[model samples]
Target: MSSNTLSAVLEKLIHRLCLNDFPCGYGTWRKTKGSTEGAETEETDALLDLLSCPHSPWRQDGSWSPQTAALRQLAVLTPERLHTDFIYSYFTTLHILDKGVSVVDDGLLKFSKLEELVLSANKISEIPAENLPSTLKILELRDNWLSALNSLTSCPPPRLQYLGLSSNSLGSHDVVCHLTGTHWPQLVCLDLSDCEFQNQQALLDALSTLPCLRTLVLEGNPFTLAPSYPGLTVDSLPRLSYLDASRISPEERCSFSSLSKITDLIEDRASATVSVGRVRGIPDPSMSLDENAPDFPVITYGYFITYEFLSHQTVDLCCSQKVSESKCDAAHVTEDIFSDADLQSNKNLSKHRTSKLTWAECMDFSDTQTYIVSDLGGLKRFFNQGLYLTLEEEKVLSWPAASEDRKGGKEKESPIKSGSTKDKDKKKKSVPDLVQDAPIRRTLGSVHVPLQGLVKRGHKVDVLCDLGTLHTESELEATQSLEKDLGKKIKEDKKKEDKESKQRGGSGTKQKNTAAFKGRGKGNKESETDVHTDNSVSVQLEPLTVELSVELEKWQSAAEANQLTLPHKSKQPDLS
Candidate 1:
């Protein structure tokens, strides 16, 4: 029989057994103090066995009620006792935690006026919304095995104001979306502390759309580890008053707003720069090093420098030749690159941003010198010295020709040499004369320091280091020997290939002579056949050679026409 029909029949049986004093006369089963064990009475045993009878809907492991082990003292409190209005109507709240209640018992369905339910610490995999009464306002289902939120969507509690679903398995993004739509309109507080959402952004985004959500508990979640979570959460959900149990301060909100605006502006600027198709970080070819340029110090330090200041700023350095080529009326190109409006904007934003140094005063660079340190001493020593260095200028030691340009020069060399046959006749070019590549610069061996120690205060000093030459005679001799050996090997290989080809050609000619003279003694027929073959080969090659010449002439004519049209187009533009 169904739970309802069996409940009805049991109710009648209980009423017949104790007609007037059924539930109130015998006091409710009391816990035995200091007694941990209790044997089941015959009546309770019979009732339990009947509940787990064959074909029962609630039977699991062939046991009478898997969830009622803690209720061993009151095993006789069957569905019949709970079905009465006198017993069920007396309670509006129920606490069934740690009871192993896998199923929402038929006994709980009788509580039509139930307002609060605590089913935490149980094996309840799911909650039947239809089984739960509509009067429930607060449902605490913490530490359960519920994997879905479909129960709430199916029979949504209209008056549910508080829900505690911490440490549950309800982590689906779809469930989060379903939650924000048309369910729990009166829900003002929600506790989903440890739901383990994999997509944190989706969860936060869905929560942003909840109109009545004020306080939210998301402690122990992976999203809490994000560095900007506080700012992002406050920015995303403006209505959220409390997040992770902390109140959102007004100052924090203002800071988040400013940060968001700055990020958006940076993104827009980057996008605009990209769309303009301007190449960045490439040094212009015209910017050659000025050998006569004077040395300039970029930093200074002394006892007079009581205060130190630091700033995080970006500097844009362009090629000097490019600056000159712009041909603007301004005295300097740097000023034009950094416009007045942009400088003012940077100055305004600088007030809001903090500097790294402890002191704020500026330094006086007059009567001070900064040393150029070698790369041998790394960052550790530099940081200990409290010195700063900025790369003011760089001089490229040598410029290498591009591969395409070098290949083109090589291809044109043959044609140029053919026309200049008289020069080759006079004297052949040497290997060094033919090679067109920049020589490697000599490395500095030893630097000469005039003074090593720190100078006295207010003393003008010029420290000069004389680096010794690194190109030794022995090294030069070794390089020349290596190059000579490589050239000799290349020539030998070429000569060997030519000798093998000549030998093969001689052998082939001998074999052909024998075949042509086979079964003949100085015969005229053989000579005639050879003459015919030679004529036939020449006749076949004549048309191909003529066609190639004609095509070459046509191409040359087209190129000449294009060259003539270019000046006419240029002259027309100039005249206009």
Candidate 2:
């Protein structure tokens, strides 16, 4: 490593330490094994895929629950993974905690120094504890269905510090704790947390006999809190230094005592919040419905954001291997061709040159300010000029690189220096000046990027210049045409909406059909009555005329009042 490299690394560590843990977002990480296809096997690749999953929106996936997807992606988010070695090595503590690790098989673990055994909180139902590590210090059987402690009748771990029987639907607490005098003599720290430790005195008294007993954690065991028989105070038992009978306080001797392997707290709020709770929308479908789903459609959207990896120029290919991409002439190329992709003109090739390798033609952004380095490594340095990236949270494919040849061509394509031609012409006209010809020693190779509106969502993202595949040309055109069509449709929709609005406005001024419909049966009955008895009807007509006049006046007032509501539609228009 160069001094410059060391300095860069130190600077990055400082920067990272000072930064608030950013939420690993779209492009936080990408798949290590870039198949752009099926199931990922490698953890790094899986990690990358998990990190990158949020960035890509699948057109066919309307049922993708974001929380569930995040959970699946963050399976390796636990602290044990930070040591990576823990996942691969297990010679220290005879271990068998293959709880819920769905994909991992038993063959991977070495189980040499592995002493602790926790098959709790898993799909596992039973196991022979006797055959486990003789050095096993703890046996976590919580959250599983283990009905008997007799399964360990043979030879349990000699130095077993803890035995968790909590949450198992197992009966016979007496038999489970029956090992105090016999089979499991070294059981010191026992966690019957959430277990039916109902036989308190029997269990506690039996447990009290364990000569090495120091810690008893009986969380969620309500029986422990029940009124002590006769008059025993809860704290009267004084053999233990720590007793976790209730919920752990943040100040509770730093969460877990000396017995826990997991960290008490994960301080990275951004990462922690991202993994909180079971992923939503799994085994729950009622969330997608509304009181009235028949009337409207629903939609969801996502955007991908990005940054550099590892805040440095060179990237770690694995745990040790490193690769540095050299940057030259302020440009880079991204090509799909592996062999003969680069087309070097025969004229440009020297006699000694045997073959031309075409990685791909490169393209530079319109006008960007960049240093003219002799190689591509310098370009990567530009990305890390700020902070450590390489976070897989925001998984995004790298921006396209421009080839040296193309960059060279682009460099030539740049506008010529002003006034240089005039100066050269004058020198050419004068013989003395011409004879005094001196090569211009002063040179400039810096490139200034021209300003352009970037992709709105990808503004912070590195722009990958694509020397897209030849077959993709039609796809590109189709995409462009689609965008144009969408724009056109949007404009048309607006116009149609405006026209409808205008028509409504024009019609709103007319009298509303505010007059109530006359009640039917009574009017027909009255007409028949009038025909059947003309003389009789004429006599009653005087009274009817007076009542009808008064009703007419009242109806007119109501019509005026109802008209007020009709214009309300015109006041507020739907923006969507």
Per TM-score, the best of the predicted structures is 1
Least accurate stretch of 10 residues (summed lDDT) in model 2? 544-553
Segments of candidate 1 deviating more than 4 angstroms: 1-83, 105-107, 258-576
How do all models score by TM-score? 0.34, 0.28
Root-mean-square deviation per candidate: 28.2, 39.3
Tens digits of per-residue lDDT for model 2 on 218-337? 544433322221111122234455566433233433322321111121110000000001111111112223565331112221111111111111111112111231232112222121
Each model's C-alpha lDDT? Answer: 0.42, 0.33
lDDT string, candidate 1, 413-495, tens digits: 32223456786555444211233343222222222222111111111223222222223233444456655664575566556
lDDT of 1 at 340: 26
